[model samples]
Every structure is written in structure tokens, then in C-alpha cells.
Target: MKPKNIGIQMTDKALLFINGVPPENLPDTINYSLIACSDGAFHYLKEKGFPLEKLDFISGDFDSHSGKDETIYHEKFIFTPDQNKTDFEKSLEIIKERGYKEVDVYGGSGGEMDHFLGNLTVAFIFKDDLKITFFDDHSHYFFAPNILVLNDVKNKLISLYPFPKAENITTKGLKWSLIKENLEITNRIGTRNFAQENSVTIEFDTGNLVVFIGN
Candidate 1:
């Protein structure tokens, strides 16, 4: 098993960019099976010269992009104007429809705090259906499954946040490990913890758990 969050080296995963802070650098397009960005993220991709031709599609309401660029990329545009869903959520739907199961997301954090939180919400909504991992300059986060094994993460910062509450949680290879403990947003939360070994295993019984691993 390889380290999942520490690197974005998987060739079978889909790559997605949202309308938050642009990534420090773009990942090699060849490493991804498919690549896409929300309409609001297109400007940053264009400004950063991210090889728009490599994108499989760009999906959103198109409010952030209009006129010239829109006309130029007409063939690549996937218009999703549903007011009920966020662009991030809509993009994930499109990705799923295209038969991609795993996605690596950039620009999912570091803009409006609400958007960051909202993105997490959408991620949680699709947690059972898709393997979505969010990447920022600082770290990578994802909704943890019942059993997760993280390799090569010794001495790195690890945080476990309960989406509201989690039950019967157990962890190994953490400096401060939890054994059948419960974490709650309103009560006890786990953050600023460090891995004690090269590999870490987390097991939990119920509720949503978001795990953040430092880059």
C-alpha cells in the first residue's frame, strides 16, 4: 500500500479544480485519466497556462466565465445551471457520470471559509459513492472510510474531525492514539496529532469522519 495523501501520483484518478486558491503548481496531466475544472476555476487555469486542451470538460453555471473565453471553449463546456447544487457538487456528478470513481481535487480550500466548509459538505454527500481527496498547499483531506491504512506518514500531522459525531473510533501509529473513543464537534475533537510510525490505521464505526494529513 502506498501513501495516498502525501502524493498525487495515481494514473487512474480524475483531477478537478475548483474556484478557490489555485494550486502552487499543476500536476502532470498525463498522470490523470481525466481532468476538469469548475467554470469559476477556468480563469485561474487559463491565467496559469494550465493547458486547457487537456481538460475533458469544464462544468458550472458559467457566471464567472462569459463572452470570449466561453465562446472559445464551447466544445469543452458542460453547462450545469442547477441552482440547487454547487459547482463543486455538479462537477463531481459529471465526473461520476463519466465513470470515474476516484478524484483528486485542487482549489478546495483557502478562499472563503464558507466555501471551504461547503466543499467539505459536498464531499461528505458523495463520500459513499466516490473516493474524493482534496489537496491544498498545506495538506490533503478526505472523508475516511470505516477502515483506512495510511503508509509513510510517520511524524506527520494528522487531524480527525467529526462531521458532527463519530463513534467507536480506534487508531494506531499515532503519538496519541484513540481506542474506541468517540469524537464530536461540540465535544471532543482530534487535531494536531502526529503519526508514531511509518504506517497508520484508523477504524471507526459510525458517522462522518474527515481525516487531514499534512503534506
Candidate 2:
């Protein structure tokens, strides 16, 4: 069966709980599936009044999820004792197995550096199969390799970070145009470029690039 498009909400073990990062207009009645990495996140959602029934499944080592509330949500849990993969990765695999083509991850930032980087790596691992976005209240980040088309959205800041190798990149409708410029990882040429027109187009010949669009 084709997996239904649902709101896959992930809760990290630690987050600063920033306000206004996740837009207030986020749909309330989501076809939601919650992935709770830590017991604190589970309790956080419970406190926020997100329904228990909406939580399709939860996976993590019990280390982060040991608490009284853990029992409350134990019926829908998958405990993987393997330390090889992070909880975020395990949850992503579940989404992929169910054939989800898109996922928006919350509570992914403001955690330990290792976990944050791990979540970022998930984007690269599944970039071809799915549109994975890491969204905090402040920003949304994703990777682009080929041509990237940006729609009309005002007052948003866009940045590009080239991976290890040099990349030949070009941009249209932006303040600066690369025009076949070689962008190195150490170079800041791709940083802080804005949209001059309604739409912005970017093309990269080589290397992975991360596009961060923020307010």
C-alpha cells in the first residue's frame, strides 16, 4: 500500500524550545506520527495536548525514554538496543519503509552537536528518495545537488554551503551570480545571497550543497 502523506513529528532528547521557529500556522489536525527520542519530549508533547492516538509509533533506546510517561506510550513503541544508529535515523527508516516521500522534522536542532549533525546526515542519505527538511521555528534546511528552483517568498534569507569539493555553480535572480564560478568549502561566495525577483534558480555542476532558507 502507498504510504499516506502525514505530519511526521520527531522530538529530540534535548531542545531549547524556541518560540516562533515553527510557524503558528502549522496545521493542527495533522495526519501526524510522533517519534519520541527521549522521555522528556514525550512528556512535552503530552503537556502540549497533542493526542496520544496521533502517535503512530515511537522508537529509541530506553536510555532517553525511561520515565513514568514511558509506560503511558509503551503500547506503540519499538525499542532498538543497537547503538549503531541514532533514534532519528531509525525513525526515518520507518518512514521510508512506509513509503513516505516527504518529511518535516521538528525538534531536530538545539540538541547535542553529534545528534544535530546526525540528523543533517539523514538528509544526505535519503535525499534521492525523499524531500527531507529539518525545521526549527527559525529556519528550514535541505540539500540540493542539481537545479534548484525557489518560489516567490519575501523577506527570506537563502544561503548555500558547498561540501568538501569545489563546485561550479550559477544563480539567476539573485544579488550575485556565480556564472560558472568554482565554490570551495572554505569560500564564502555562496553565503547570504537573496532573491531579487519572484523566483530564484540555482544550478550546481558538482559537490553536495546545503540550501538554508530562513527569515
Q: What is the C-alpha lDDT of each candidate?
A: 0.91, 0.63
In terms of lDDT, the poorest run of 10 residues in model 1 is 1-10
**RMSD (Cα, Å) of model 1:** 4.7
User: Could you tell me the TM-score of candidate 1?
Assistant: 0.92
In order of appearance, the predictions have TM-scores of 0.92, 0.77
For each predicted model, how many residue pairs clash, with residues at least 3 apart or on different chains?
0, 3
Q: Which one wins on lDDT?
A: 1
In candidate 1, residue 169 scores what lDDT? Answer: 97
Q: Mind sharing the TM-score for model 2? A: 0.77
For candidate 2, write residues 1-215 as lDDT tens digits.
Answer: 32234455433211111111223333343343333333234555655665655566666666755566567777877776677866667777777776667666666666467666766776688888777776776677888758999887444678887755437688888777678777767755477877777788889888888888874
**Candidate 1: which pairs clash?**
none
lDDT of 1 by residue, 45-156 (tens): 9999888887889998787776897788999999999999999999999999878889999999997899999999999889878999999889999999999999999989
Ten-residue stretch with the least lDDT total in model 2: 12-21
Give me the displacement of residue 202 in model 2, in angstroms.
0.9
